[model samples]
Target: MKLYHSTASPYVRKVLMTAWECGLASRIELLPASGTPAAPNRDMAARNPLMKIPTLIRDDGSELYDSIVICEYFDSLAGGTLFPPAGEARWQVLRRHALVDGLLDSALAVRYETVARPEPLRWQEWIDGHSAKIDNALDALEREVDALPAAFQIDQIALVAALGYLDFRFASRPWRPGRPKLERWFARLSERESAKRTVPT
Candidate 1:
């Protein structure tokens, strides 16, 4: 299997972490794909219609796009380790994943709005909207993060990656305030081998 991945992408890190957690990291090849997102190379487009990073092309010529889907596939291949087996616990996990995913998306949008656009074209309003989502999501997660289990899963993986990305790209925004549990949780997750290996440069 070949994975079209970027070293600095949080979304891509989710899939990589999933593979590592599932003990399938060695089976896939990571390929660096360079191009503006608007005009990604044809090869990437072939694997993923969106021409996005973290696209997984399996040995059988099958492909999976999006980090969530890729993580699910990895967990399936590993006989269900990355996600919960079933029931309300599963829904909570999915909800946590969504929260982290939303935070990442918002952070990415704020980044592109600032760096990719001309100064005059920059939109603080748009940036603020997403930034607000990140803030509120952190607040919500911090409120209940302590209740979650200690073991790793896709939801926890994504939550940690999202918080790590904020520290990566938005250090100006401090989310550790009044959120001791969430901060401690993230601090612990940071010690994981997967996180140490995949930390954004």
Candidate 2:
């Protein structure tokens, strides 16, 4: 398998971390690809119409895009260790995954607004709205932290990936002030080999 990757992309890091957790990292090859929405890499656009990183090209020449899809594919290949197969546990995990993705969506919106947009075009209201979403998500995660599985899971991977991105891009706005549970949870997860291996540069 070949993966289009950007070292600093949290989404790509999520996929790679999933691969590592699934013990399939050695079976994949990473191809460097980096572009922003304003000027996308044509090479990557050809493979994925959305021009997103973490696009997976399987050995059969088929393609898969989006971090969640790629991560689930890797999990399936590893005999479904990362996801709960069925029952209420599955819905709980999926809900957490959605929350994490929503948090990331708001974060990336803030990034593009502040860094990609011209200063004159940047809107403080928009950034603040997204930042509030991030805060709310963090609060939710803190409340749910005690229920997190003992074993590493996909939601845990997603949470770690999102938090790592916040630390990477929004360091000026710290996230650990009142959320000690989440802060400590992130610290503990950071010790995992997959988390260490996929740290964004």
**Per-candidate clashes, comma-separated:** 0, 0
Badly placed stretches (over 4 Å) of model 2 are none
Q: TM-score for candidate 1, please give it.
A: 0.94
**lDDT of candidates 1 onward, in order:** 0.85, 0.92
* Per-residue alpha-carbon lDDT of candidate 2 for residues 73-153, written as tens digits (9 for 90 to 100): 999888967888888888898899999999999999999999998999999999999989999999999999988978788
Q: Candidate 1's residue-wise lDDT over 1-201, tens digit each? A: 999988878998898888888888899899997554545677777677788888888999899888899999988988976787788888888998998899888888888888766789898889889988988999999888888876688899898778888888878777788889888989988998878878876
Best by TM-score: 2
Model 1: lDDT to the true structure: 0.85
Off by over 4 Å in 1: 35-42
